[model samples]
Target: MDLIRRLFTAALVAGVLSGTAASVVQQATTVPLILEAEKYEVVTPPPATAAPTTTAPAASHAEGHQHGPVREVGEGVPVTLDEAMQRIGLTIAANLIAGVAYALLLAAAILLAGRPVDARRGLVWGMGGFVAVSLAPSFGLAPELPGMAGAELELRQLWWLSAAAGAGVGIAALAFARNRLVIAVAILAAALPHLIGAPHPESAEGAVPAELAARFVTASLGSAALFWAILGSVCGWLMSGVVEPAESRPALRVQPGAR
Candidate 1:
């Protein structure tokens, strides 16, 4: 039993370590591409000029007409590819730590309650954690798309698809592993938000009246929920091996008249 426990712990630790490494590698590869794109062009506005004076009456009349207030579009802060990549890496690391902590807490709770938790249940719990954590940001902030307008914003479709794929993978992994009830519950809990739907920014005040915006918001939320649920499930599964299952006693048979 002690050996088994140690083995499980080792496996969980290894899996988490590998995942962290992979995340680092991914950031390293993508950051350069992003930087190259940003460096391709630099836009500089022309110098300011004084208003030309009109000589003719007709010219004076046209020049004197007042125009509506010009909306001042502020220049956005420039983030180099390396900086963006570093930020992403940091975010991933933070989330990974949080996920692992949550998984450990859940495991401890189940053990304290004298319940036998398996890999499957751990995954479910992970998913639930994902949903719970993601909710605050999803509703509180508006979606922003810099450098994208009209059809270009369709790039969001990729995000949705990726999310769906992640959820599907999580479900499949659980089914294959045949995890326990608790894990199943966690997975479902994590997935509920995506299925329940997200608050649309289009419904918020000051949004443009485009039909796609509403759909985009809804789909994006749904997709993200799915993706995170799967991700959490996988992480939980990896960590589940670390927790020891409660021992079951063998049934005793009494011989006739034996005390």
Candidate 2:
């Protein structure tokens, strides 16, 4: 119970800090690009050749738009305060939740390894996570804007999970296994996904400007980097504080002739 409580407490603090930082940076960088892309989401449906009784709205999904749950807000008109608040609030909430989850996972892994959790080690874990979860996957997927078409969700999800798992294993080998043969295998393991290539739709098209898309991609990566770094640092520091440091333990002071 005490362990659980401490872990939760640490997670709460780490999550709040990491999530807020990621959200703010994302807002500053990626949010605007998403808004800009949404302006193009008002697609007119293909002419109804089938029936005159068609009750479908005059506007339907754009040809290039991939169906998904990502919210599209940028219309021609200015955004209302309420709408802005809602979006911002939702973003904040998402960040907080994600941050907490990542922190909890990191803390558990650290404790499991019987290693000291400190800011430096946390930073490494966090960065490794970013590499495994974001950087490697993005090499193929990148970030998509509204109306961007892609391969089926299942395919993407499968590849992503496999890639992450592979990267994790490869990294573990690189970090822990000392043999040259092990390192070679690790390199191959990490490179395998890229070698096979990520699945993509037949067409590569989107309504968003190339420049804006590029910016958003860069910003998203940057924000993720920031999030992981903060999570590691905060979680590490918090956990270290919660547990007594090894060096801080009272050293055995032997008196002369005590033996």
Candidate 3:
């Protein structure tokens, strides 16, 4: 129970701080881009031969306008206080939750590695995480903005999970393994997802400008890297005090053979 408490405490602190940072960064970088893209999300007219009763086209247009759960607000309309607050609240909450989950996972890895923890080491691990989770998968699927085209959600999600997992496993093996065969396998694992290829939309048409989408992807990656770095460094700093290594323990002193 004590061990668990300490772990959770470290994770909670790291998560909150990192998550707060992520929220602020997102607000500054990604939020405005998303809003601008949403304004361009007006439904494109269907082909003349397309059936009017068919809803697939309309559904696709509607889904394309959303980056996530947030509803669309119209252009030139004033954003109400409540609505703005809700968006902010949701953003913060989501970031916090993600941070906490990531922190816990990092903590577990650190424990398993049984290495003395410090900010520098933590930062390295965190960067590794960003590469595996964000950078690697992103090669295939860059961050999507509102009014952007993408493959089906389910297919994308599966590929993302596989890519992240493979990259993480491959990285870990490459770092620790000594055997040549194992190293070769690690390289293969990392490359397998890209080899399989990510699903893509039939057409790459999108209402959002190419420049905006590129910016969104870059901002998202930068934000993720920042968040992970913070979470890792903080977690390591906190955990350093939680689990005392044998070498770090103080030596008992004898007072001139007074025993």
Candidate 4:
């Protein structure tokens, strides 16, 4: 029970810090690109017969913007300071939640592996996470901008999970396995998801420019890398007793009292 409590405490702290950092990175990079992409998002118009008045189209367009791509602010409308702050707050909150979840998982893995974790080793573990979760799946499905075409959300999600899991297993095997056959199997496991391929939209066309999309993908991956790095290092440091030297101290010995 004590170990569990300590583990959770470490995870929570690491997660909050990692999430905060990730939110900053996203606000600076991905958020702007998403706003730009929203400008080019394609919205289907209401049929002419449904419109009783000329103003209907305008109303319909506004409604479309509200429903599309999770963008709360209206199109062509300047975002107020309050709205911008609200958006940032929401982003940070969401990132924090995600960070906590990730930290918990990473911590569990470390415990299960039964390896000594330190800040330096944690960095390597974090990079391994980046490779498993980001780099591997990305080869099949690069991160998409708001306006970009994509496969059905469910399908994409399914593939992403499969790829991440496969890559994780493969990474663990490579790190721990000494047998030649086991290493070969690990490589195959990592490759299997990509070989099956990711689902894609029938048409590749999208309103957002390819250059913008490329930038968004790069920024997303970079930010993910940053998040994992912080999470791993902080979790390791905390769990390794470096952050709580008193708690980690050995019990003091009582010497025989001199009369």
Assess every candidate by TM-score.
0.38, 0.79, 0.82, 0.82
Candidate 3 lDDT, 181-212, residue by residue in tens:
99889889889999999999999998778998
The regions of model 1 sitting more than 4 angstroms off are 1-74, 135-247, 251-259
Q: Model 4 Cα displacement at 175 (Å)?
A: 0.5
90-194 in candidate 4: lDDT tens per residue?
Answer: 999999999899899998988887777889988888889989999999999999987788989999999999999999989999998889898898889888989
lDDT by residue for model 2 (41-86), tens: 6555445457554344433344225443343435543589999999
Positional deviation of 80 in candidate 2, in angstroms?
3.0
lDDT string, candidate 1, 103-133, tens digits: 4544443344343345566556545544444
**How high is the lDDT of residue 97 in model 2?**
93
What would the TM-score be for candidate 1 when compared with the true structure?
0.38
The C-alpha local distance difference test score for the whole of candidate 2 amounts to 0.81
Question: How well does candidate 2 match the true structure in TM-score terms?
Answer: 0.79
Worst 10 residues of 2 by lDDT: 62-71
- Report clash pairs, candidate 1: 120-183, 121-182, 121-183, 124-186, 124-187, 125-186, 127-190
Q: What shift in Å separates residue 65 of candidate 2 from its native position after superposition? A: 23
